[model samples]
Target: MRRSSSFVLGAVALACAGPDRDAAPASPTSSDATGTSGGSTTVSGSAGTGSATTEAGDTNGATIGDTTGDDGASSSGGAELGVPMFVAQGMVGRTTVSCDDGLTWIGERSWDVEGDAHLCGSTTPVDCSGSGSTCTQRWFDGSCSEEACDCGHSPGFSKGVEHGAGRFVATWGWGWPGAVATSTNGFDWQTTLDGDTFGGLRYGGGRFVVASRTPQTSLDGITWTASQEADFHGDDGVTIWSVRRFGFADVDGGRFVAYASGDTSVDTLISSDGGGSWWRPRSMPSDCLGEGPGAYGDIIAGNGVIVMVDGDGHACRSDDGGSSWTAHTITDSRIASSGVWTGDEFWFWGFGSRYSSADGITWTTTPIDAPDDIGPVARSPEGTLVAVNNVWLGYEQQAFLRSTDGVTWASLPDGDFTPGHPIFFIAFGHAEPSAMCPGT
Candidate 1:
């Protein structure tokens, strides 16, 4: 959500106040992924009496400050509910304060630092002080070691994929036209495409496919050509269905299955010829509409099964390629925002919880120490699950988390990149020969 000008005014008032400040500090609230506007979050100091109502914004609602009583020791009226910590777009928000058994916000001291929006009281600085042609560090005990990395280049709301043999392709939504970057290792990167904005990027059937109004395909992830035969338009040809989200999976033999969700229409297109051509195989089940929006969900194929899950945890699976689908429940109550298949099991994180399933039919929830509103998770080149979480101070900042088994997670030192815009997607990429450089 756009920051209201009133936030500036509130900041000025708190800055000029006397040493014994009595007024509560104002914190900026965030909107949901759909860009839906909601109510304003109001927090008061002195008694720390504040109330946050559910809004149409991000699934996690708002991020507020710690409410403290007059004595600053005991709790009063501020512990009723919990607020979400901000992440990037489409992901759930986390809570900043430590909670009790009931999950109520109960931190005595305020985690919000005045004037610095990116600085968090709980954030630990990372040490990048090692030497190597390219040294890789690990996230241990909530801090990063002194190794360097080359994966810091900003792609402007980008998504990437590790094609194979250390080759990577990352495409962005806004910035230069056809904005794309390629890397050979997981670290270094170089721009390859500069044409039009792309919606999604995936690799299958011996090529890289980019989803847009008219999808494009490339064998090298550099030069691109439009799939003239691939059709996304409805039967009318005038009602062009917008491709919001899509997923690719390799079925039996070398054949691949691509499931695409439409932005405005309920019709979903399926491709069997490696995204060369698309046809409406079937419509989403009526019961799936309860999962929030029909156009928004994560479609993943792995372990010989293709799974499509909506925002509300409603899931459907296809075993005989994309020809047929069977709807199933996740058993958990929390709504899932994003999910990824880790070659073996399907893992989903949202609303302050993480769940994993090997068959996509039954799920097992795991306990996570991180915030509930964490961003999307992808398998890094090193075979670890990496995810990002945002800390909304005075400014927006990010936190990195890594899990080797997808069950237990650890925090990596914060990356140097502070997003100036909302990041819509992030995937693993390989480093290129020309893009290889010393780690910072």
Candidate 2:
């Protein structure tokens, strides 16, 4: 276990030497523990903490090593029937995958993919073999059907967030008539809102906000009310065009920050009165601007700071909320797409690489050993970092990988949900029955 110390900027240092207004305090020093055996890392914070230990094998019952004990049971309790992790809304129609542990997954609970009841009623594990099979399918991206399932109604983007204890909501779609699903335990889900696609969904300022054609807010993630179009302008004092990406983060103190990425530059929107009204503090640095046409990413906040990473390896950091910014260059320029603040550090991942930074200013890169392209990465309630693989091309079946320290990874075997088309969205639920968190 290689331990790394984090360098955090104090709130006083980040405060502008002006009037002393009430500001959110800086977060405590976060500690992460990695287990050498299962490749699971336990992060410590308010969200919860997890620890690593030796496990038998992949959850899908595939033989990797001596995972099962003499009694034909896993010593790590991974093989036991546990809480199910619900997967919802993928490239095809309304489909979802569920897993108790990360090893075994069930469901490809699909609906109206080929204009038929194919794989719609069946709750059995996914079958990758056969003609017109659900396993070797891909969405309509000008790809061969045999190689991938090129179909319509595929999800463009999907996002989810925990609102309260045992309460969660997710929104996804490509165009109008998008869908929203809600769950109390991360297992059984129910669709609440349909129609009207939303680019992002977040919980902050005592309400749930969704960035759709127009921003919408909800008190319980069920009923919603629409707001005016968000104001997105560049430093040139002109509204940037072709907004491609949207993101939001809670900056504490009943305040929140929202981000929108356009073809020319990225814009920031700050809300002191929750989601009621938003204003722009200052424009981002020139280096934080988008590179080519239709290029954009998102911004993530943690430990009293906000960070934005684009597809061009350029990242901007803001200590005093999203009012001001500073740019930082990443070592690997492979277009960092998604990132998460693990309380201790920021972990970013793209196609073939993973990068981590203690201070969000300086970064170190590591090559990921994924069988195919890496899609979305999230920290499971168990404290394990779970990442999706093989989402781009349909040549191979989609899979998942788990990592503890971001250095070592383990591939789950082919089970019910293992051998299927890549899912566009993956998120960790607040309901953690396994209690994978350490010292819980």
Candidate 3:
């Protein structure tokens, strides 16, 4: 494996290889390991130790690559909270996704889009997939669904949530400045429009790590304040496409893991203290981050072992998150779309089918009832794993699918849930999707 520790224009002097693994970048001299601040080369201090014994967003051994084979999620309160499953529609009085530590999560999205934009609106305050089958009255902008104008997408609603006080926070990243929104319970929300595409999100250690298509961050979960901000639209290092809540692994301290498109190099990034800092990204051992606008990432339990059939073909495992990965590649032309954490395994869906892995690795693929593009994957605090597929064209495709286990797939009916805005997926949740408690 390549390693980097230097100060060249403040960019973390990475010790990695490109498509040519043989061309590993030289490791910086000892003094350089103690990186300096400022510029892209900056990665040091108590805050930037960049230790291999490091962790991003959560999901691995605090001692990088130290997989002892025991996933400590049972104690992380995951089991105690009943294997978080997505609640298609959070029962009004109760919070949607709750925590093992007694905290409740609420994502009450309040967006205002024009009529022409009706692929679907925030159907409910929380779960947004509506009867995309029926052509909406008109578009949000031009009555021609094609020109739908909007203020932002939706996350769903909120109710009486019980998060571990301070442990409960929210982060949203719309497409523009002051466009992001957050809420402790799906009821109250804070907004930001820093011009970042808020893909996936998670709340931890009193802050939020909002992942964008680029490398942007925020200090508070409700704001776009960052210790360091990068041009989210810039062409540079790692480019994270999505963010998710990896609360499955149950790491105690503040940390999070964001599955994103690494710069020209790595395919994923892990952040321990929200998005304040990042580790040198690593590429997927098998597939490249994909050519489609598709996002790639799979959650791991306490042991840092992931059962991912996400985006890439075949099942894979990353004992060290993406820092060091090992995957089983397949020639099948398919995408391992979205997934969830089952009490005993991980499940994902895509290309009209479903797949699962017991230890976050190895898999059993099969056909399912959902259409393509199942991006929003959530395993509620109640253990209902829900995955949604976005069919911008209507009944020609099914919008969302549900899974009781990471393997089985089903449909989420929009019976009573108020299809508030129309955010089919504001998905958060992963085994350490945010960060795993210390040891696994």
Candidate 4:
């Protein structure tokens, strides 16, 4: 079942240097991968109230806008239920926080290798399964010393993080081995798959799908099945081999959409039967990749609509389920890194002012105070919007922001997270797996 909020909803640049780039060699096998709107609803107080409701058409529907509450803690008064915590993945590591109401956040776990160093000799990869370690590691030549470290790898860094179909999934990008981390509860994680992987992850139709040079799917996010066709040939006679990079993958209108951009062209692939089969829609326009400095951006699906935008001011939207697309230019030359759907509107944000649209075309600009890139936004089931700025730099005190109405934002305190660590993506997901299945 699709996760929903009573209201309605809704990336990263692939070329920028991830914080881990200095510590680790880029994965030769992986591919580079890599918002807001309306309202002025104010959420007051701290977080973790567990009093927010996400069911649509509630009596409070008429009260969603222009309402003020006592200053106890902020509450969206909506968000997807069963989601007990917030999951964040970035260059520093993966961490979780508990905030039932999406206002006052409390730390849950820092799920990355922080202080501990693992040694695996010159050619061997560091084994991060030891105590105080969880895969994100700096590899050294022959010792566990942090100095003279040659390379490092994290399953999910500045790319490939998605939450859906009952699990939160994160994966490593190019130059590293294919690694995936799955969590039913944000507090704990399991490395479910490794090897022969490229990260363009999406969970839908009762399964998890990864689109790469090869396409693979999993019923439980553990064992993956790869497709037989290694080369993806579009109806236009254009063929892309082993998708080099994924712009973004999302499920909207009960259809799974994955955007793949190679050296020559940009392609949009859609799967109607829960990722069991995929076919290219009419190919996205070439300019959808962007003419700006950063060539890539993100995609979002909701309310029978799918929209994609790149950092260079190009956008594409599909209303009839990816069969055809209409192109539009983002206003003010806005460079978008990420976007989201807020029940009633679509939003795109990046370097400067944020933009929101009721449809995917015309937009309304909202001013913000970020001096650097502001992006990778996510919404809670109860309708809280969380965004991080200075994605590559910035301290936690100034990096995290939350809003119930998307218009007003407040700084969020650091919760068991490294103060200066940069965040890549934020998602709301269940703390427990909804079910289990046998795997290969």
Clashes of each: 23, 14, 92, 31
- Model 2 agreement with the true structure over 27-115: per-residue lDDT tens digits: 11222222222332222211112211111211111111211111112223443333435343444333444454445455443343343
Top-down lDDT ranking: 4, 2, 1, 3
- By lDDT, the better pick of 1 and 4 is 4
Q: Predictions ranked by TM-score, top down?
A: 4, 2, 1, 3
Best by lDDT: 4
lDDT of each: 0.41, 0.46, 0.35, 0.47
Residue range 1-440, candidate 4, lDDT tens digits: 21111111101232342321221112111111113335321111111112111212111111111111111111334443454556666543345454454554444333233331222222322232122422333322222333221122342333456665456777654433436778766655676765434646655444666776567777777777876343454334566443423432232324556654334333456665545556665434433433321223466655556777555445566676666656565553445346766767776664446666676665566665543345567776557777665444334233566777665666555553344344556666655632221111
Which residue segments of model 2 deviate by more than 4 Å? 1-89, 93-99, 113-165, 233-243, 254-256, 261-266, 291-298, 350-352, 367-373, 390-395, 432-440
The best candidate in terms of TM-score: 4
**Candidate 3: misplaced stretches above 4 Å?**
1-110, 113-175, 192-199, 204-207, 212-225, 229-255, 259-267, 281-302, 306-316, 330-333, 367-375, 391-403, 406-414, 418-440
Every model: Cα RMSD to truth:
19.8, 16.0, 15.3, 13.7
TM-score of each: 0.56, 0.64, 0.52, 0.65
Task: Give one digit per residue, the lDDT tens place, for model 1 in 1-440.
Answer: 32322233333232212122223222112111211123211111011112211111111112121211111111223322211111122111111111111111121111111211111122322211111223222232223233232112111224433343235566643211325656554333465665455556766555677775577777777777777444444323434333445676655432233333232222355655545565553433433322222122467766777777664455666666655555565533433335676656777664555656677665555556653244555554235555554211112444445566655666543333332222234443322322222122
lDDT of 2 at 177: 42
